[model samples]
Target: MPKFFNTAGPCQSDIHYTLPTGDRLPQLEKLIAQRNYFVIHAPRQTGKTTAMLTLAQELTASGAYTAVLLSLEVGAVFPHDPGAAERAILDEWKQSIKFRLPENLYPPEWPDTNAGSMIGTLLSNWAKKASRPLVVFLDEIEALSDETLISVLRQLRSGYPNRPQGFPHSLALIGMRDVRDYKIAGGGSQRLNSSSPFNIKVESLTLQNFSLADVKNLYKQHTEATGQIFTPEAIERAFYLTDGQPWLVNAIARQATEVLAPDVATPITVDLINQAKEILIQRQDTHLDSLAERLREDRVKAVMQPILAGQDLPNVPNDDIQYLVDLGLCKIDNGQGLEIANPIYQEVLPRVLSYTTNASMGRIESRWLSDKGELMPMELLEAFLGFWKQHGEPLFKSTPYPEIAPHIVLMAFLHRVVNGGGTIEREYAIGSGRMDICLHYGKVILAMELKVWREGKRDPLDEGLQQLDKYLSGLNLDTGWLVIFDRRPDLLPLSDRTTTEIATSPAGRSIIVIRG
Candidate 1:
């Protein structure tokens, strides 16, 4: 069968388009060779499984060690029952070893042990039987929760002294989080002792996304196989949109080649990659949906809510911020500070946040469109003004984040434009209390900035004008919209207070100023 991009599961070399998984993490061999226990983590679908599986095969092939990949995910089903979880994990490992290692390399039968010491004892007996030193990679270690997670960690740590004889010579716990961030069932990490569980001597590492060179090499494989090409611009654009996210890189290419264009003769272009992005967002594939699900958690909200509002983040725990970074939702740039991880994530965040308001919106007519189906900028503006008069207050009451309520309402309104075949790109000026939207239609590109007039703060008109002027210049447009929504405690009713008028920006460009 012809090789294709694999997204549903770990990439297999013979059947999937894959890169050298080891190249992404060159320290694995050295770390294992040193008989160190370490942790491997990254956001979900980041090729952690694939990398570990590949590494296991390579090490076992070297004949110096017996290595195998095992998973604890099935154990998660019995969060509070360490015994049952351990049994299930071991049963799964039997199959993994059968699949991963040669028959002669398979260890003697698992050591039958009581509930609490099953994992350690099993590894001990297996290592003693193996012809070579044993190396094990435990994937989805975080899935073993509550008593199970803590129990497994302690067992592994307790068995550390028996390495090369009684226990595996090298072991790695793999999951989406670092050792410190493992989730306990029903609550926080308070259930864990600071150092009792996984304080083994070694390093904690993350598998990074593909680099630009990796992306280029990956796409080159598809080109070589199919005789179709990804233009230089398309590869760069894909890298930019995805930040070399493994799932996203394959997803975009898969969507383009398999669904969007599909013809091997037709080259994959930048436009197709852009279209694939829209489809993936619409599809909300399992990976993206999993990320969206994280948005509802309070831990995620503590940092994200402020980031979404363009306000300075409140005093949140450092781990809370790192939680997001670990999840790949946000990253800290040295100069730019904390921001969304990549362009695709930045685009998805606001839309997912405002999903409820977008769904609650009543029917929208085509009144804003010209006869040619082109979006009439003024008509669309009028539609928003009318909608705000009727639904803006309710939207505010319904918004999930009060600090970003107006911004969400505006996005909800603009989503209608997107449904009418237009697109809106947004940028948030963090700590500036502002968001800018650039709407693209057939030949009309409209720019707008949203700012709030909070209590104790003067009207933001002058600052907004100066900002919008720069924004408009960036769009190479001579005009744009600056909206100031009054959010003070004593503000008047929405219908009565909303108003719009024409003005000039600081750069002498025509500006539509809307103060509500």
Candidate 2:
């Protein structure tokens, strides 16, 4: 059978297009040789499990180490019962060893001990009995609750001094975050600790998303296996859309090859890649849905709300922002400012929050469309003005992120207009002070920039117009709209305050200044 893209779990080279797992982490052998107990973490689905598993196989095959990959996830189920969690975890570990290792390499039965300290004892016994030095990768270490996690980490730290002879020579704690960012809660406390119990880590290593070359090499595997070709533009577009996210990279190609364009001879194109993205978002695949779930987190909120409103970032802790970066929700930009990690996430974040509002909206007639079914820019603007005058206030209260409520309402309204037939691309970042949108409709492109006029702040009309001019230049458009929302107190009702005016940008671009 021809190999295809794998998105759900660790990639199997036999049936998946995979990069050499060792290429991504060249220091693993050196780290192991040094008897280091380190960490390897990245956002979910970025090939952590795949790399570790491959590394384990390679080390065991070389007869230099008795390597195994084990999971701590079972322990999460017994969060309050550390003893029970450890028993379950060790049982799972034994089963895993039975399946993965030869009889000579199998661990002796775990020593009988109190459940709380079983993991440490188990590893100690295994290393002592093994023919070669033992190396273990502990996966899903973050799933354990605070007390359980603390227990496990303390055990590992306690066992750290007994290397080579009594404990695993090298160990890796694998999860979605570095050791420092683990969310340790419960036990009647709601505060995060900066210094965790597992501070003995020699180093923390992160697996990066696939590079452009890595993505191309992966796609080439499919082309070599089958006659199907992915256009160079398609690969580049895929990389751009996903920012090299491994799951997304595979998902896009998988959808395009297996669903969007199944014929072996039909080459994948940029348009097909985009369609795959839309389909993935619409379907809310497990990977994307997992990320959407993080939006409600307080740490995630502190960083994300500013980006949504295009306001200056709040005084959030650096570690909080770094946590989001580790989770792949955001990334450090060229200038070290944080932004949404990729275009797909940029779209998913707003739409997921506005989902209920988008659904609750009452029936709206297609007043913005011309007789020929094309979107009329002026008509669309008028329709939005009418909607805002009628429903914007109530809709604002319906959203959780009030700072970006207006932006969400506007996006919700535009969502109704586009409805999958068109596309809306948003550009906003911390410190941008405005959100810019580019609407793509049938044979027409409309640009818009939204700013809020606060009571104590100066009206941003002039600044908005200047910014819109620069935005229009990029779109190669001669006209666009600058929407300034008047959020000042003592303002009249929406009907009275909402209005529009035609103005010109400094670069002579036609600007529709909508004051609402």
Best by lDDT: 2
Q: How close is each model in CA RMSD to the real structure?
A: 1.4, 1.5
TM-score of each: 0.97, 0.97
lDDT of 2 by residue, 453-502 (tens): 98789989999988988999998999998989888888898878898888
Clash totals in order: 0, 0
Question: Where does candidate 2 stray beyond 4 Å?
Answer: 187-192
Candidate 2 lDDT score relative to the true structure: 0.88
Indicate the TM-score of model 1: 0.97
lDDT of 1 by residue, 270-371 (tens): 999999988877678999888988987888888888787678988898888888989999888898889888888887888888889998887878688889
